[model samples]
Every structure is written in structure tokens, then in C-alpha cells.
Target: MEKIKISKDEVTHVAHLARLEFGEAETEKFTAQLNGILRYMDKLNEVDTNGVEPVTHAIARKNAFREDAVNASLPPEASLANAPESRGGCFLVPKVIE
Candidate 1:
């Protein structure tokens, strides 16, 4: 498997783009970690998966839910009773805009 090498400058550039400031120690540490992850991905690329079939779900099942139906809603008076203020059967809240 080919090895991956991440440089300090690349790490610093990425940090700057992300609006983060990293010291020298953090930059070196992140470089080593990112390179290690890339090496692992390269190793995974060697696997032979030509005959594998694509799957959308782990368990072969369709929608497992009840059919939708119309339901009764609470009366407006009961719903507005909980509000601190109401006008003409409508809940009133503080105006958000002038």
C-alpha cells in the first residue's frame, strides 16, 4: 500500500480557511493524524468488491407504518385558554417588528 504524507503547511492552510488558529504542536499532530487516515483509506481501496450488490436498507422490508388518516383537532377555545393574551378567538403575541 502507498503511504500518505501530509505537510505542516497544508494543515496550517486548512486551519486558516476554517477560521482556526493552530500552534506548531497542534499542526504537527493533525498532520500525522490526517496522513494516517489517508493511508487507511488507501489500504481499503485494495479490497475486491466487484460482485457486491448495492443495498438501500439493512433489513429487506417496506414502509413499517400505519396508513395516514384524518384526526379530530382540539377546539379553538380550549387551545387559546393556555395563551396569556387573545383577541377575537386568536392568540396574541408581542409584535416582533415595528
Candidate 2:
């Protein structure tokens, strides 16, 4: 017989922490499913990964983005062109906080 990885009480506790409501049948089902997943992970641990390089993505891809370039800064006049109210060199707005 295989040893169970997660118990019913532990599943119930986890459900409570997640604010989830479940019946006895649902709890039992979740316990079995979680145990199955853990057992598969345990099986995966048996594989020897001595000299394998970890990869971020499964497929190769090119950088589909434009190169960054330096640009001239916008003048105060151009920046405040569309402003409803500009005081000195900035936009003026109603007071939000007291």
C-alpha cells in the first residue's frame, strides 16, 4: 500500500485558510487529487538531473521589440499645450486632500 501524502484534516485546514466551503465528499475528493499530484512529484524526484542546464522557455524566440534610442525632451510650452490650467510651468488642478 502507498502512503498518503496529504490528509483530510490538512485539506480542510487549507480550505478554511482560502475561505472555501466544502462538504465531506468534496474534501475527500480534494485529498485524493492532491495526494496523486504529490505522488507524481515524488516520482519525478527519482530522475537524475546531474548536468542539465535549466531553460526559461521551452521554445526559441527572437526579440520582437524596437531598439531603445535617446530622444529630445519636450519643452514646457509643448508639454503644457493641452493643459486646462497651467501655473508657471505645470498643470494646476483642484485640491484633492485637506
How close is each model in CA RMSD to the real structure? 9.4, 10.8
The residue-level lDDT of candidate 1 at 29 comes to 90
lDDT top scorer: 2
| Candidate 1: tens digits of C-alpha lDDT, residues 1-98 | 54656678988888889999888888889999998887777876788889999798788788788769878899999999999999999989899899
Which residue window of length 10 is worst by lDDT in model 1?
A: 1-10
Tell me the lDDT of candidate 1. 0.85
Give the distance in Å from residue 44's predicted Cα in candidate 1 to where it truly belongs.
3.5
lDDT of 2 at 46: 81
Give the Cα error of residue 44 in candidate 2, in Å: 3.0
True lDDT of residue 33, candidate 2? 96
Q: List the residue pairs that clash in candidate 2.
A: none
**Which candidate's TM-score is highest?**
2
